[model samples]
Target chain A: MKRLDIIRRAGRNLKQAKVRTLLTALAISVGAFTLTLSLAIGAGTREYFAKFLETNVNPQSLFVVADKKLVGFEGGNTGPKEYDPGAANISGSSYKTLGQSDLDKIAANKNISSVQPNYNLEATYFTYQGNSKKFTGQVGMYDKTIRGEAAAGSLPKLGTMIGADDIVVPESYLKALGIKNAKDAIGKTITVHVVQQAQTKTTEELQALYAQGGLDALTAATQGKSQDVSFKISAVAAKPATALSDNVQLNISDTRAQELADFTTQGTSQHKRYIAAIAMVKDGVKPETVKAELEKTGLTVKTARDLQGILFTVVNVVQGIVAGFGILALLASIFGIINTQYISVLERTGQIGLMKALGMSNRAIGRLFRYEAAWIGFLGAILGALGGIGLGTLLNPWISRKMSLGAGSHLLIFQPLPICLLILALVLVAIVAGWFPSRKAARLDPIEALRTE
Target chain B: MIELKGVTKTYGKGGNTFTALDNINLTIPDAAVVAVVGKSGSGKSTLMHIMSGLDRPSEGSVTVSGRNLHDLKKKELDQFRAREISFIFQSFFVQGGDSCYDNVSLPLEIAGVPRSKRQQRVEKALESVELTDKTRQKAKNLSGGQKQRLAIARAIAGQPRILFADEPTGNLDSATGAVVEKLLFDYARANKATLVVVTHDQDLAAKCDIQIHVKDGRITEVKQ
Candidate 1:
């Protein structure tokens, strides 16, 4: 018989035994449901993380830092290692110190376009206009690599850095500054105060300065006092929706931030120390290549892809566990198909005899039963996948609300290719599950089968 | 023409061997109505099985037309059966769940007839068996006589050159049995096809153009 005829006959036979066929398919559907849902959730989370990176991170940038082990820290390793005299991060080196030497090594790489050491801006108070009251909150740098959305005014455009004398403040700072709104605060001045460190002086030098200028000069030479810098309010940003970094009260231009950092550490032992630096890759260079080279020199380099991996690893494990359960259900359902098909074969012995006597080949007989199983699989997979998608669509809003992922974010997303491949794979599994029973049906003797009546 | 030469069929092994057909030689002419009559287990059914290529003989050969049945490959034998051989069983053997049209369409489908042309063939076969009105009804819903007619419709639907009727009227009343007998004979005469009837009813066997009587795994008499 032609394959199309066999397939049609198979479908008809399954239709004849409707209840049994559906029950078997239902068993398979349980697994398919779990697997498809897990796949959707997996794809959703991965895609969401990628979108998060796209908005906030530069793909062509690498974050480089001195490895704790390279900087003479014990790190996560258990065993002791031999010490070297040139080890950094020692006492007086300050926190997360990647000094001038580390910066120099990174700058020497051929693929690197520029290196900007992440500077720490220290401030004791922020006061804008007539609001002289000191409000202590963290200050951060607005650099070219940092992408932000403004609430009222516009942020720096692509390839452009924040102006040296401008600051971006949040809504809370606007309210603290007694400004009516973000729009009103634009072009207004905000002052940040820091205590400048006094330089050390010998008594001889202090006496010479006092002899030239009297008591006022002596007090000025020995005393340390607060200093304030002013910047125009250039824009306003909302509270960050991402979990990437701490929330800052206001942001200053990168150049001014560096100057503040330099002013704070002048004539100090930790003057050139840095916590992290963004190594911008050349236009056509792959970030991974430069990352590898930076790592070879004992620096820890992380590309955007690595960050995405870090985030998705957790998602993979969770989704894998769910899909694993689905596989277990599928394995259990295979036995269901075996049992059902075997019973079908037994029930249709006479019919099989009739077909065989009518000249249906043993191969066709086998294909008949196998295609019936394929039908069952196709039905179950379609039902289960559609069920997952339906429930996913309905539950997305609830999940987003509960997880506080802001608006327009979904926790369940279905992609076509994986779902189609998944259904095809399930159908193949069902065919294999039907194999032994189909063989039993095929090998049945027409004479014995006819005589069975 | 169907020819059997020194055909022998035995069952089991060593000590328990039972011969079902012993040294049977026969020649059946084309377009003839032949009856094989015997008591139960008298090897008449076994004879029919071998002659129809449903079973292989332990020794010798059976040929239909020009092809040696035993020498044919498995696929070739199947194709031969699909195209040239048809059967009507004692129990009516019609698929109960399928519609009358579908039941009759089975043979044509197995013969690799395309769907577009099978409908006319099926309708014609059903019309011949006088089940044309019951074409859409499930075979199980038909009475014994109608089911038997439907089985006959299925048998002739493939337009086979040879038809086997194994007690085709065994399950029907005398009245219905007479009707089935007429249908089988009419189909044979109209198509100019060879008809072989295996039966226990002596009266039914007596109506054939030729009769082969069997006893104890051997043919005892041939009547014309």
Candidate 2:
């Protein structure tokens, strides 16, 4: 008999025993339902991480901080135990700071493609030319990793730094800068002010100044200096200034940030101290390998993978628990398939004998039963997947709202390709479950089968 | 033509065995109607099975249409039976859920006949049995006589050279039995196909051209 004919016959036979077929398929659907849900969650969480990584940083970039034995989210807490002199206190907790020499050591490595020291640039106020009214906001340097897409001008080319004279303004800053929009703001200049402390007069110098004039002269010699710098508005970034986010940030070039850092902390202890550094690994080199090299030199490094693990730790555990139930359900359903096929083989013994007497080969008889199992698997997976996807689609908005996730980001995302592959795999598993029963059916003696009544 | 030589079939193994057929030598000529009449344990069903290539003899050889059953591979034996032989059992093995047309076309479908060719053959076989109007009816809805006739239609649809009837009328009344028996004989004689009837009824055996009597696993008499 032709294979297609056998399959048709098998399908017809399954239809005749609808209750048994459905019960077996239901068993498999139990597993498929849970598995689909788990997979959706896994895909959803992973997608957010991927989107976050691309916009903020690249995979090759690792956040390098001093090996301070840090275990807290900056300034949260650290149960007091050890007090090392090397660990400097910031806000409340202590952490080792990255020094100039430490930066030099990292820059000298063979695998270090580039290093960008995270500079703390503080601008007291900023105003456009002819606009004396100054707006105080957050000021930071334009590191290439902060990939804020442009609203007016082009971003720096990949693997390059912003020019020293350039500063990027936000669309929201147009009103304060007296410009209509980003186009008008381009090529305009803005002034930033920072106070530079003067050197303290020594005792002998103070005594000579006091003798020359009075207390007034000494006071004049030790007063702080106020300096102002202006930079051209190069571009307007799209992401930095949203209406809801009132904390505006103005970005200056790396050279400008360095200049501000040099002058502001000229006499202070924080002149050469840095909070962290971002190291770029060379192309074709693994970040973890270089991270290991950096760790050997007492510098703590974190790759993107480690951060993802930390970020997804809770979600992953939940997924594993749900997937465990799915696996257990699948294991039980395999037996359900075997039992169903065995009962079918037993009930159809007389039919099998008659088919054999009618010249249907034993191989065809076996194929008929196996095809029935495959059909059951296809049905179960589709039903289960549809159920999972349907429920997920309906619940996604509610879930996001309850979890306080941002708009347009759902808690569950169903990817098409893996779902298709999952269905295929379930079908194969059903075939394997039907194996022994089909073999038994094929090897039955026609003479004995005919006498089975 | 079919031939059997020194055929011995036994059941069980080693210490305990029951001989079904003992050293039976028989030859069936072409287009002949023959009956092997026997009591309940005479192994008449075993003889039909071996001759139809549904079972093999424990010893000796059986050949049909110049192909020895023992020499044929498993696939070839199935093909040979599909093309050259057909059977009608006492219990009317037509599928109860199937239509009369589907019942008749079972042998042809098993033989891999194309769909375009099967419809004509099935209708013709149903017409020959005078059940053309009932072709669309399910086999279970037919009377005992109609069921047996449907079995005959199934047997002859593929036009096999040999037909084996194992108590073809055992489940029907005399009038119904007579109708089934007449259709079987008329079709065999009209088509010039060999017919082998296995039964315990002496009256049915007498209707055939030849009769062989069996007792205690051995042939006791031959009437030709």
Candidate 3:
């Protein structure tokens, strides 16, 4: 018999037994649905992580910090360290901050184009109109490379001078100031009062005092002597300005930042030292190579790509496990296919005998049964894929909203290649499942089959 | 011509062994209507099965149109049966789920007749059996004689060289049986195909041009 004829006969047979065919197809559909959904979730999560990394990290820049082990005895120390009055006490250990000489040494590398030092600003109160709010501030040289997205306005342009009159606030700062929109706070001038004390104190000592008596006692201890400086709000970012809790950041020109450091510690022997620096690698230079060069100077370097890789690995593992379960479901469905075909063969014994006596080849008879299985697989896969995509699309908007992942984001994403492969795989599995039953039908003795009631 | 020489068929093995056909020898000329009359268990049906290549003989060779049935491979034997022979059973063996047209079209399809020609041939075959008006009706809904007529249409639709009917009118009333018997004889004469009928009815057996009688799994007599 021709292949088309066999297929037609198989389809007719399946139609004759509609309920059995439908139930068997449903079993296969369960597996296909789960597998497709898992793949979609994996793709969506990885895409989201990639976007986060792109928006928050600069590919060409490396974060350079003092050796973490040598920075603090809390990390574990081999011996007692010499005491330096100018050293910043961080986490119960006094560590030398990055000085001019250290910056010069890092800047001498051939691949390093520029280095911007981060400044530690003292606690101060900012008054806008009649409302005064105390906030801890950190001063940094304004550069276009700093990683943060603006809710309104834009970051300070590269090579543009940011003097004492310029500052960048956080989203929380705007909320605290009763501003409903980020764009409304742009170009507003606020007065920042820097409290200058008569005596210089270690960072740890200052923190202890602030914890004990709040900012009011520290203000009184400074004899109320403070200098007021005015700065214009340049931009508002979504993330907080500094790692410090509740603290906002002020961006100023390097010259102005140096001037503030000198004025804040002028009464004592302490001098200006930077907490950390960001090294900008030139175009076409590998950041890893530059990181290796920087590590030789006793500095720790990290790149955004490394962090993104770790996140992607985690997503892949999760996807693998979910897909594994889907495969198990498909495996179970394979047995269902086998059982259905066997029953069909038994029910059609007399019909099969008639066909054989009509001179249909055993091979043709086998192919007819296999074609029936293929049809079941095809229907199941289509139903499963459509159901998975439908559910994903239905849940995407609510999930995005709940997770605060901006509009147009989907938590479940379907990629075409893998889904097509999944359908093909199901068909192949169905064919395999039909093999034994088809063989049994083919080898049946026509005389005996006809003799069966 | 079709010939069966020393053909014997056995079932099972060891103590369960049973011989269904014992050294059967027979010959029927082309275009002749022949009947093999026997009681149940007399192996007349087994003789038809072996002649049609539906069953293999344990001993001897059967040949049709000068081709040895035993020498052909499984696929070739099937092809030979499809192209040169057709069958109608006592039970009709119509696919009840299908339309009368589909029931008649099965043999042609199995013979690999191109789709373009199958409809015309199937229509002509059904018309010869006077079932064209009921072509669209499911086989299960047809009367006993109509079902047998549909089976006859299916067997002759492929225009094979040989036709085998095992008690073709056994389930029908006399009036309906007469109509089916006349249709079968007329179709065989028009196609010049050898017709072999197996039956216990003396009236139907006497109508054929030749008759063979069987008893105890062996042919007892032949009359021409």
Candidate 4:
């Protein structure tokens, strides 16, 4: 028999058993819906992370930090030793910070083009026309590539070292200072008082002062004698809002930051330390090679791509779990196909006999049954994919809003190739599920089948 | 012509065996109307099955239209039956869920007749059975006589050289049975096709050109 005729007959047979065919197809749709949704979510998350990286990270830059084991006594201790008063206690661990020598060693590498140390500065109160306010503040060197959009005035030019008297404030500072607009504050000057331990002659002497008087004795010693530095506001920057870091209100040049540390530690023996540094690699050099060379110097190196890779791995795991469940549902539906097809064969025994008596080949009979299964699969996949896309579209707005993603961002994104491949795969699965039952129908004895009423 | 020489068919294995046909020897010339009449379990149906290549004989051979049925493989036999032979069953066996048009088109479809040609042949077959006006009605909705006629239309749709009717009117009333019988015989005679009828009705058997009687799994008489 011709394939078209067999397919038409199969369609007619399915129509004859409408309820059974529909129920079987429904079972397959459940699996298809889940599979499509999972794939969409995986694609959406990847796109989202890719955008985040593009917007916030510089591909050629690597963040270098002191190795955790070298920076902390928290992991395990070799032995207890005498304590040092000059060591900084950070996150419940006392460790020496990265200093000028560490920065120099990293900069000396052939692959590294430049190094910018992230300064850990002491906080101070801001004073403007006798009104003083304490706010959470940190001063960091500004890299032109890392700066966000400017709300007022222009960002200081790249490679222009910030003078000791230059400063940049966030938009929140303008609101707090009662400045009418960011442009108005750009040329104004503000005084920041640097409080210190009153310039002790030696490390032992400063340690004695800290132990005897704590903060009050130190404050009394520096009473009526704080160094007030006046700085002109170079620009007012837009608020930095991201999941990782925000709430910074001050920016300065790396040279100016080092100068403030020098002023505070005058007449003392302690050297300035940094928490981390950013190494900007030259273009066309592999970041991995630079990272490996830096790692040899006992520093931990991480590129933006590495962090993005971690996020991708996490997203892939989630997609895998969801797809696994979808496959399980499909496996269950396969049995449903087999069951429905077997029952159909039994019910149509006399018809089978009639066809065979009319000289229909066994291969033709098998093809008919398989064609019916393929039809069911096609219907199920199309319905399930459309359902998934519809539900995703309906839920996109609420999900985007909840996540604070801007308008037009989607949490479920569909791509054409994967969806089509998924549908084809499901059809193949249905064909495989129908194989045994179709073969049984094909091999049935015409005499016996005709005798079956 | 259809010929069976020393043919035997057995069911089951070992000690549980039962013979459905025993040493059957028969020949019916082309375009002849032959009736195989017998009581139930007397091997009339088995003889028809073997001769039609629907069942294989355990011993000896059956031949039809110069093709040895035993020499042909199963697939070859299917092709032979599809192109050369047709059947009308006692139960009608018309696909009830299908329309009369589809029921009549089955054999032609199996023969791989194109749609355009199949349409013409189907219409002619339906007209021959006098069911042309009911072509689109579902087979289940047809009366017994109409369903029987639909079966005859399907059987002859491929224009096969041989026709087999197994108790074709057994389920119909006397009046409906006579109408169905007349259509079957008329189509076969018009086409000059060999017609074999399996029946228990002596009156119906008497109308055929040749009669064969069977008893105890063997043919006891052949009268022409």
Candidate 5:
């Protein structure tokens, strides 16, 4: 018989057994729907989660903690221990020094694109005023490591440094010190007290006393007793609110003073210590490669995924298990097709006999049955796939509304290859399921079939 | 012309082998009505199956129009059947749930007859059997006699050279069976095609131009 005739006949037969056929098709469709939805959802989740992480954290930056050997400390400095004054928090280097030499070696590393070394400093001084005040303050110095452009004014140049020694005071300081306009403070000189240990001689005290005269009369009066030293201010810099450095009340006057300052804090003071470096890799270089290089320096480097920790692993495992269950549902639907085809054969026995009597060869009979089964499977799969996509789209809003974290599910794009593969799989199952019944129908003896009531 | 030369069809193997057509040799001339009469399991239906090219003979060849039916491949035999052979069954072998017209149009459709022209041929064939008025009626709703006429209309719709009827009137009452038998012989006579009928009714067999008596898979008598 012609294929069109066979198809028409098969369609009529299905219509005859409408309830059963519909039920079977429904089972197959449900299986396909769940399978498709699971795969799409899993894919979208991965893409969305990865995108979220990328947005929240820097994609091309490496985090650097202090290398103990690089710290030049004899004892290993490891783990996070809070700085408690009662606890002997002795610094192997009195000065928090990751001096210029260490910065040079880091810059020379092959993958190192640009380096931003950070240090904090605190100092104390006597004021001209009778009352002495201690400056337990902090400072951070970075070289062009700021994340974005300053909202106002020209940015400081690459060589321009912000340190406790070169204080770019925050706007809060303007309010606290009763300074007028920020521009007026620029180029103005002020005396800051610098305190020293008892071992320092009278020459240092006299020098500090002379510098206090530069301070405002009130500040000068308080320096001799409470403030230890005074210094000349060169420039007052503009500062944004998130600035990382403390006020620079005093800076080294000459190379001799700097050397003396470095030596004084070398063995005992943990204050003014620098422990971390944050660097940016060049645009083309991968952040991962920089991280690997940093690890070799005995410093633990971290990436976004590392920081995300157990959450990333858990997401992947959950998706896998859910997909596995969906696969099981798909398999059961295939078996459901087999059962439906078998039942269909039993119901169509008389029809088979009639076709055979009409001079339909065994081959024609086989083709008819096979085509019937295949049509059922193909239609079921198509409807199921469409339903799956529709359901996924519908559920997207509900999921997103229920949990804001589920936002970004647009990552669940339907992949063409998987959909095609699913259709092909259904076709295969249909053909296989039809095989036995088709053969049985074809093998029917004409005389025996005619004899059937 | 149809000729069965020493045709033998055996079933099963080992000790269970039973010959359904035991060395049955017969010749049916063109444009003649022939009836094969036998009891149940007498191998009359087997004879029709082999003659219609729906089956293969195990030990012999069936020749029609000088071509060996046994020699044709499965697909070639199917085309041969669609083009030259047709069938009528006693229990009305119309596809159920379809209109009588669709059942009659089925063979023509399978033969790839053009739809624009198929209706005319189907109408003429149905009219030959006096079923033109019932064309839109479902086969399931037709009386036994009407369904048998519909089956006969379906069998002859493609204008085949030969028609095989397996107890074509067996399910009808005597009056209805007579009507169906008359229709079959009349159509075959008008078309000048060979007609082969298998029936247990002696009266039905008597109406044919020739008769073959099959007893226990063997033809015991052939009367002309």
Candidate 6:
């Protein structure tokens, strides 16, 4: 039969059982809507969160320790002798630190991309207007500074001996400390107390002290208990600030904050107090490939993704559940379509028989039923998609408010690509749901159907 | 031509077995009008169904236009029925929800006739049934006589070699049924199609070229 003729006939048949068809269409649409909305929202949230984290830090930074035999005991009095914590080196002694020469080599490689030097000092504090503000700060102490900069003060001149006096603080710290202006904090003296672990005290006490007063106080306590070096104030320096999370302002300089042994403090001996020299590539560069290259150099490179495995996992789980709901909805909708079509079939038994008596092939009859169902599903999907997007838009503000996710000023982020994908998914569900019943109707025994009184 | 040989149709299994048709043999030739007269449970409808390939007999075989009905798959059987036969019911089973034109055009449409051809054919059929003016009207709007004529028009439109009419006048009053009967004969004569009407009405059976009496799933006699 001409497709047009079949369509016309199908349309007539559908009208004969209008209520049933509509109900089925509604059910299918609900299912499709659920599936689409869940997957889309979940995926979108992941993308947004990942980007937020990536923009703030080096996604491919790695830390490599020079420990060849490191191990730890679960209890203080161990059943087995504990090896040095950083002694298990991923690479041998032939492995070198990612110094200037290594960075120069990395820069030459096309895949290596941009590499920035990293130095983090923990025993840092800034003193503004004679009041000392203690905070944990990473001292990049870069031959070239990457991102850490005072919201107000100029970067210290290179090789100008940034010592126990020069420091910069993060904008957030300035805000938290009730310093509305960054200018009030410049030319300030800060103290950085580098605390090396002592043979005289246990690691637990040192950790407790570090956690209580940060690196500066921990270093001072360690020094008081063993080494006799008075902690002094240093110049103030700023830390990186972002809208995503909270950060503390730190005091940092180019030189050692304290006259502590480099190996004892910056080495395996000081397990709790560690500083990693992380090199960050630009945002667009592929972190994974560069990470592999860094791995080859015996430096343990990791993506921000690897470091935030827990966060990523949690987000994924949430998204998965939401998507599962969406899938369930789509499935429910599909069953709804099937149910509606089945009712239609029951109502149109006589009509189907009449068509067969008039010389319709089973295939033709099947096609008619299928066409009717498909039309219903297609309509439902289109409508459901519109409904879902509208719902997403409507719920955006409420969702953001509840989630506390700062999705900019717009309430609904109508991501066209995600929405399009959702629509496609819903349509597929609608179509699949219509399949079985349409076939069943098509395969009905002509005589039995005709005899359906 | 349609032929049935040793056809037996049994329902259920073992002790519950009941034969709807028992070793029935019959032949219906092209351009001939034949009628089967029987009571409600006399196997007339069963015979009609088997002849139309709507059901396969438990035993024996049926052939129409040299093709065995039992051998065709369900889909193939449907195709065969669409291409080779048209069936009319006593109730004048036009789809009530659709316009008369849509009802009459259904068979042609199902056969995948182009829309233009379907419209032309439907118009012609409606004209033949003298319901051309009512083509756009829903089947439910037509009178009883008009509905019967619409059914007749639909049956004839497909140009099938064999036309099976099951109590084509069963639901109509005598006067209306007479008119419908005349239209059936006229349709058969005009198209040179074989007509097989299964009915219990003696008057209707007498009008055909040949008449067969059915009793208890068996044929008792044939008259011509």
Question: lDDT tens digits, residues A1-453, model 5?
Answer: 677778877777777777877777777777677767766866666666666555444566665655443322244555556554322233532213344555566677777776654433335532222224333433223333333222222335532443333323333344435456665544443344334333323665556756765545334434333233333333444332222233333332333234334433443343333455666677778877877887786565655556444344555677667667766766776677677777766666766776665567787788777777777777778888898888778777776555444444463557778887887787677778778887887887765676666
Per-model TM values vs. the true structure: 0.77, 0.70, 0.74, 0.78, 0.66, 0.73
TM-score of 4: 0.78
Question: Top TM-score: which candidate number?
Answer: 4
Off by over 4 Å in 3: A62-109, A114-146, A150-279, A286-309, A415-417
- Writing each residue's lDDT as its tens digit, candidate 1 over B25-135 gives 999999999999999999999998898898999998999997899889988999999999999999877889889988999999888999999999999999998999999
Candidate 2: tens digits of C-alpha lDDT, residues A226-276: 779899888887653211133257788878888897787676666767778
Each candidate's lDDT (Cα)? 0.86, 0.83, 0.82, 0.82, 0.68, 0.67
- Give per-residue CA lDDT, model 1, range A1-453, as digits (tens): 788888887898888889998999999999999999999999988878888888878888887776543222344444444553323343433234578888899989998988888776679887777775878888877767757668777788754677899888876666666778779888888898877677678889988998999999888866766678999888887655543443455888778888888887665555667768888999899999998888888788888788787778878988999999999999999999999999989988989999999999999899999999999999989988988888899999998877666687787999999999999999999999999999999999998888866
Pairwise TM-score winner, candidates 1 and 6: 1
lDDT of 4 by residue, A109-205 (tens): 9888888877655547765543466544555566544536578877755434556567778777766687887888887877766655454346676
Error of 1 at B165 (Å): 1.5
lDDT of 2 by residue, B45-140 (tens): 898899999999999999888878999999999888888888888888777777888788778878999879999999999999999999999888
Model 4: residues with Cα > 4 Å off, grouped in runs: A64-105, A116-277, A283-302
When just chain B is superposed on the true chain B, each candidate scores a TM-score of 0.99, 0.98, 0.96, 0.98, 0.97, 0.97
Native-referenced Cα lDDT, model 6: 0.67
Q: Which pairs clash inside model 4?
A: none
Highest DockQ scorer: 4
lDDT of 5 by residue, B1-224 (tens): 99999999998999989898999889999998999999988999889888888778889989997899877887677678888888888777676788888898888876778878889999999998898889898898988888888888898899999999988877888898889888888888988999999999898899898999999999999989
On the 0 to 100 scale, the lDDT of residue A353 in model 1 is: 92
TM-score of chain B of 6: 0.97
Error of 6 at A180 (Å): 4.3
> B52-167 in candidate 3: lDDT tens per residue?
88888999999888888899999999988888888888888888889999888888889999999999999999998889899899999998988998998899899988999998
TM-score of chain B of 2: 0.98
